[model samples]
Target chain A: MQKNQSIEIGALLLEIGALLMSAGANTNRIRLTMRRIAKSYGYKAEYLITHRAIMLTLQNPNGDLAFNQVKQTYAQVPNFMMVSGISRLSWRIVDENLSVETVWQEIERLKLLPKYPRLIILATVALACAAFCRLGGGNFTEMLIVFLASFSGLFIKQELGKKKVNPYFGVFLASFITTMICGVIGIWYPFQHDNMAFVTSVLYLIPGIPLINSISDIMDGNSLNGIIRALNGVVISFAIASGLLIAILIFNAV
Target chain B: MDWIDFFEKWIWFGVAAIGFAILFNVPKRTLIPIFIMAALGGSVKLVLLHWGDSLVLGTLLGAVLIGFLSIYAAHFKHSPPFVFAIPAVIPMVPGSYAYYTMKGIIKLSNNSNTTDFVPLLNDTITNGFKTLFILMAIAIGVFAPMLLTRRDSAKQIKMPLLKQDKK
Candidate 1:
């Protein structure tokens, strides 16, 4: 009886960690996708994780829940990558009623694909072009510059993924490259309203920390956190603004 | 933009929906219903905006009405509320407007020589506040029911209903 209770408790902890990792997902889009994946594995209430925050859905008839560290450990590994297939692995553990530690060991035995950098680059470039077209009134030249900036960032993330560079530095380089492109546009075409469009479109890549944090705050019933997330969003907006303004100022000075 | 022109340009909503659908890997089959619902809501908003009425009131009404519609649609389709609710409302997302406001603020700062910062500041503040109000309006409409009813209804409500109630 005690053993089964332990397993249920372990699974609950795993769910909570997944909730936190998923709460700030790139957009609710990722969360939605995860729910679909979970559904394919016959896991209902996938969206419940977002609300319940923690739960024990799996229980053993013998009164022995499969509690062990392995299940939780396996769950965490996929946090950094696409989790579609992770649900499948999780289902295996659930169906077998295996110990959490055993599930982790089994997950290690399964072959997993490494994160592909080219896909990230392609997605970034495509989205950048789309955003530019949307915001800049289809100004071809502005679209070209935004594409180049996004491309440079993609290449940097690739290098970081390969362990040839640090990820934070990579993201900063990407940000600088993007900012520089926007700065040049501002200097060359000071009168056009399209520059605003160009900058706003690129802001999509700015991590959406505000929305995620806000939702997380609300889900946790923490009003302070929600307010903080909203403020954070504004601050980040200003920070991006400051970065762009400072760049243009330096350019004008030169 | 006029009514017909509104729908024509409202292609942006479709684009947003498709973009979100692809990013999230939602089933292609589910896209049409979501798109149509967003279009309906978006058209109402565009109409209200054209009438020179309060955009806040328009947004609030649009969100609440759309929220209710999404819940109904989810029931009819036998899908989760988050499924229909999230994508169906993409047209209402404040993404574009928020982008414009932030960009406006930055451009104002760039014009350091201009003494007209007051007007620019007004526009920025107005937009910033408007975006917040719009999102909160949507959340109030959507989350209020979900919160009031209690959390984790999928575990509690979905199964028994699915078993006993056949639509």
Candidate 2:
């Protein structure tokens, strides 16, 4: 019984970590990730992201009878706001009594998604380019061109939604799309030098993951962990910049 | 620069109010009231500046006051404080400033004719960060009161979970 409970707890932590990494709090990706994490813990966890705040409820097998008790318990956690959109992920661990090891394992499992790396890279590039375009007032035609490339990245991952394609290959295709689009924009666009617009719009893709995660880490009173997450955000931003720089250099050379 | 020029620039005050209201998803009913209030608030800053107050400080206070009033309106309707506060904040967002800074960098970089590209980018990003932080600080200040007043009641109310079936 204890072992089963431990496994469930591990699964819950894993889900929260994964949900946090996906950029944008209210997107389909975060929702899907949260659902998967909750299911792993065997608890009937549900969530809602409204204009005001993100709310969640967890129902253990004690049924609705114990729901109030669970709610009260969670209401006491001073740093609950730290979880924000990823609250479902964190709440599952708390409810199921999972350990750190279980959470770490699940975090590891998320890498299995195949296209994970590629998605990260592609998203970063697309965002950077979009920010640049918006800043430059690059015109509808320029935006349309950039959008075509970013959409290609999104399309590569779309099959993940359909389950017909492996996530790894999807990421690769997405990265290729990002590279192709950004490279073309750099060489062909008259306003190729405007990295700011590209970067700003790209900020949308910059994964609020780091921002929220760092904030959460601080709120949870774990400065080291929070700093690590903050650093991760910087690293991810650099990764995206590196990809954009490489694409631009290669495209310019050719 | 002249009165006509100055009057033209204030158009953004209205633009700011509307953009904030919509982005925060304010209900249609409250839009007009909030817009009027925001204009009033913006004008107050203008008046204060003419009287020799610091424009930035005056504007910051104006944003806070506007946020507080909007929250009060929300309170009157039994609406969530967060709901109203967001739109109230729209007028204060530094959208145009962020846009121009970013645009300058991209233009300079592409042309390769400017020695000041690096400085321009850094300055622009710094300004964007400062603006974002100020906005966030004001938001929290506005939101703090709501949390304190509603803490007990929020506990009693069972917020419906939208993704209930997912589990």
Candidate 3:
């Protein structure tokens, strides 16, 4: 194999490792995707992934080994767009036997694809919160209050997240603001179920996706990463409860 | 939960799933189908719960259906199974049960006058386990499909995973 070919393969493998990590792919799936991609290129690959980082080893020219470690800089948020995009790219690699240069360019394009607009996310989340309220059997009045609170809370979360705030702190702020809004509403108008508003307003903030992923990881025998992800979910739940507890104390609603 | 009100929740769960799909940045074209999958899972739960069944049973049944459906959706949408499976399982996350578990702990802490801790413990334990089991159900249900259909992924990648990934 040419020196240039080996270098390109190493770079491609590292970039894909980093992409899978940042895209919120679990450790097992990351290894699977990396292995498959490497094999398709007529190379061998191995990886050790934890919650915080990824260490990938690929066999290069002359049977030499190449190692790359990708440290996750940001928190993991599921972007199905990127997830699906990566999935398709791997398959395309197999189908076309594409050169490393073309595959790398495709990854760059996927990384640049814009996420859904911020306004759309906020509006939809608020409506989802109202849906939770209705699912909780709350009346229209309660659902409206939850809708407003969720809107403001998700807005704060999105803004603070962009400002590079710690993800946990963002969750805390969102839940606190949401529960506080419901608390104030409770003081103004006592409804049949004021507490449901408090519960459902922050329903949008639960780490459902991560929690499910964690369990899936464990079942796939990636227990270390799975346990870590589950612990992250527990911590997020605690942050939410702390915020809600503070609001409850302030309103003396408990 | 009467017939009318029970059916009403189907729409809400569908809407909630759309919010989740949006938040996750699923492709714009996949939103409507994701909503339907979520609502379908929720209705499965509703039917089971309507018969005075345990929430664990209902959630497990619902998740099983969602898990099976997510495979087809992933194939059709040209996305990974996790993308659809994760969001579809959202409507049955048992968030309220977990919240109640926490609230029960807080209530017990605040019980200066009340001597009865039994009910508090009961509330916390019952709800806490409900949350745990519901999560387990969702996990197992979603993964069962992937485990069974390893051949689906195996077809895409000709590499043999079992021989090398011993750990």
Each model's lDDT: 0.49, 0.46, 0.80
Ranking by DockQ: 3, 1, 2
TM of each candidate vs. truth: 0.61, 0.39, 0.92
Ranking by TM-score: 3, 1, 2
Instruction: After superposing candidate 3 on the true structure, give the runs of residues whose Cα lies further than 4 Å from its correct spot.
Output: A66-74, B113-115, B149-167
Which 10 consecutive residues of model 2 chain A have the lowest summed lDDT? A69-78
**DockQ of candidate 2 against the true complex:** 0.08
Local lDDT at B76 for model 3: 63
- Model 1 residue A238 distance off true place after TM-score fit, in angstroms: 5.1
**In candidate 2, what are the lDDT values of residues A154-185, reduced to their tens digit?**
55545554675543344444444565665566
Is 1 or 2 the stronger prediction by DockQ?
Answer: 1
Best by DockQ: 3
Q: Worst 10-residue stretch by lDDT in candidate 1 chain B?
A: B153-162
Higher-TM-score candidate of 2 and 3 = 3
Q: Candidate 1: DockQ?
A: 0.15
Cα misplacement distance, residue A7 of candidate 1 (Å): 3.3
Please rank every candidate by lDDT, starting with the best.
3, 1, 2
On TM-score, the candidate that comes out on top is 3
Residue B17 local lDDT, model 3: 88
TM-score (second chain) of model 3: 0.84
lDDT of 1 by residue, A14-49 (tens): 543353344333223334443433333334322223
